[model samples]
Target: MRLKNCLFIGCLSLMSLPALAETVNNLFQVREPVSGQTPDEKTRATQAALETLVTRLTGDAKAAQGATLAEVRKDPQQIISQYGYDAGPPESLQVDFDPASTERALRQAGLALWGSNRPVIMAWWLNDATDGANLVGDGQSSAEPLRRAAQHRGLPLRLPLADLGEQSIGNAKTLDGTDVAPLKQASERYGPDAILAVHAQENGSQWQGKWHLWLGDKMEQGSASGASAAELADAVLLSVSQRLAPRFVVKPGASSSMALEVQGMTLERYAQLVRLLEPFGGRLRSVNGDRVVFDVSGSVDQLRSQLSLARLQEVPAGEVGAAPVDAGQTPAVEAKPGSTNVSLPAGTADQTLHLRW
Candidate 1:
């Protein structure tokens, strides 16, 4: 089989946080084919798009049936910011909603908001062909269906390069094996936030597959069957979203205030940090040098979990609240003999955190 390292240009551009953020900001957008730009057609399309956007943002397919959805339908224009037509033989209409208004509706509805800054999953897909089994790589035709499913679910998926270096780590044997260490090693180059291993086979008109996903130190595996490749891909996306929803979903409730010390604080870094935290309903209560206190709607544990997923490194407990340092400066301190610095446990209250960017 021919293995290539090329990735989709569009996919590669999403690697940066800024780019990812921009994409997430537009998560509420939807495009649908239309026969003509008639008033009735536009209205119907807008409503459909709004429903899709609500479901996509909440990760709950039934979110559209809720009270907030009713409010949106009552005055759809309240949430819709702009929309236009795309040139096509079968004309298509694109709708864009106001993010702030949509989010407020979600919060008022007491539903969780699955923000767009999601974890990037590196997927290793293997398919059984007539001649033999083939590994799916970047831009492979066979993988297009899976990519569309990922887009539908708003999940970002990257395929392996399957280069000589990757093959040396493991091949189909290691991928199909019970051990996942080799696959993890092979995935390091992509800097994935998580790893997914999927093996699919076609039986007549139906498709079946088993998949394994590793997020941080946790691992989950499942099997699915579908009537079509698209159906199978949607099933896979649903399973993956189930695993991710708990960690990323923002449920509504009373707000909580937490104190945190952030090392390496600068004017620019502080602004960036606020933007990152704003999605979680974080508001700055106070900022004294590197230490910050935030009034956030979510619990401290939830906040920590989200930050970790965002790639922020947790400063060792001893380092928390250590005097603020200027940009590009490191703190110099000698550890005491026979004294060990213990890192705070997960869910610890008011622990200090640091951003790696």
Candidate 2:
């Protein structure tokens, strides 16, 4: 079960928090092509699907084969909720893993899991075919492969409309250029948190792409080649997932418990805050006026990444009116009626963190 589920079960009514980043739905759902419907084939396909899911969630291509997940690989159905075969040009198996069970299992295995709240990626892809070079637009047929790739890798990808002005800016020079001013200017209208630029060319029947990803102050660039466009797209998205996961994934044993204070809390904001802090094992420490304190466990970067989703501002440690409050030093106050019990950790002044909602 998710840590939030443990803390809030039957305690407070839960509602979806307004997320700053796009929440990629169906992260646990995976589909892998199969050659036949035989029992052995289905079993093998199921294992392959589980491997794909583990890779997608942890951003480690070999996670499913790791010693930590050996038992899970032996009994793949332990966390699966449902499965069915999709009759396609290439037959495929669609597996839906129970999210809670899967999460619990992964945590128990000591693997770092990436949350569903992922950044929205705007992709500007320029394709060079034998006939000519063109940009892949939002409504174009060529964009379908990229969408499938994004979904398979659990990325929220968006394509521009490819209007005349955008096409002018989405050229080879702009895609390959180190300077992102032109691309960022064009991407502002799309409102994506990250920008992806790809220049793919088809030589004979093989496809290869040079890609660049820009997020915050970080920029990553790489090249990928595949037998076809679909394969190339999948390779590129997998690389992107690998790059993005480390920024958010909270590995086991890497977290330190600390006191966190969030000011400007109301009933509604409280609900939102709870959901946002779920991954950090956020436990209510106390409530004073609109300010609320929590005992949370995670790295500073991970906490900052999650709280940024709610537009929370971090108050410096020694601010005049915003000094960090040690939860242990604060007098104990009874939790509101029907609230679940959260054990407050023993903390000192230096172990406290503060934020403003």
Candidate 3:
């Protein structure tokens, strides 16, 4: 009887397990540069901020222009929790959207949403300037623009220390090559879920970058140009956000019911798993010893991605096989006296997935 039923309170509609990925905060807050403090300027910038927020939450570049969100675009102020201007070298207006209101509005519009529980990215950026080439370290002046852009794009970006050893590893060949072994080896200390390498150079007044990203077995490459380093960083990070969204985003009308059974379940792990599966609508079925069963709704891929964040490994077929459990139906687990195994009904393996942490 090591398992216990747990209560779960849903937070933002995002999926990142506590131990596996970093939980990003202030996702609903957005800041956009403004020309002046006039009412008209504020309105315009606020509207722009709303568009940026929508793009960040949805991970679609053109989502701001979708017809479904026309009403939200018309009255963006309804979701604003608070807004004000920041005084600085380049002034900006900051808007904080109400989480509950924003989530409701987006769901009502039938739009797919990406959660704030996202993977942390390690950025290995090399800036080739007229003076000399340098690596953007975590504590260097060159890192500010990248940090700002990462925050704006809702990416959890990390920078390397750029010591002599790391600088030797950050050469042009390592940054631009198809082989990621060298960069991956260098990023071992950073503990990021993904790695991004950028080879940027100053061409007269404009900055151009050729960037490559590696996550798991997949890789993405693109190029961007901007008038300044900040703009270039923003463009590159925006592209990264767009590329990463589809793998984790859950669409409104694209879900199916499935049964999930996890071994090594405890009360604490049960609570954590519940939060991780919030977006999938996980409902508990039964708890026996260190095992627990849950009925959840979502694609198998989505559920697999969510569970992986908690370091859960899927058991191979025919190894602790599962029987399908319908919606609102309890899984049939037969417990016999003095037996450690709970038997599952036969011939329903395809509809259920078995995993262990």
lDDT of each: 0.63, 0.80, 0.79
lDDT of 2 at 206: 95
Using TM-score as the measure, the top candidate is 3
**TM-score to true structure, per model:** 0.70, 0.84, 0.85
Candidate 2 lDDT tens digits, 143-262: 998998999899999999999999999999999887888999999988888899999999998999999998876799999988998899999999999988887887788888887888
Give the lDDT of residue 195 in candidate 2. 92
Arrange candidates by lDDT, highest first: which order? Answer: 2, 3, 1
Q: Which of candidates 1 and 3 reaches a greater lDDT? A: 3
lDDT-wise, the better of 1 and 2 is 2
Query: What lDDT tens digits, residue by residue, belong to model 1 across residues 34-64?
Result: 8789999998888777776776787776787
Off by over 4 Å in 1: 1-25, 31-51, 71-78, 81-94, 164-173, 176-178, 264-272, 284-295, 310-357
Across residues 1-357, which tens digit of lDDT does each residue of candidate 3 receive?
Answer: 223423122112213324355667799999999999999999999889988998899898788888988988898989999998898546999999999999999888888788776778999999998999999999999999998899999999999999999999998889988788988999988888889999999999999999999877789999999999999999999999998887778787778777788887765566567666667656566655577777677788877766766778888777774432344333332221122223334322236778987
Q: Which 10 residues in a row give candidate 3 its minimum summed lDDT?
A: 5-14
Compared with the true structure, model 1 gives a TM-score of 0.70
Residue 117 of candidate 3: its Cα lDDT?
A: 69
- Residue 354 miss distance in model 1 (angstroms): 8.5
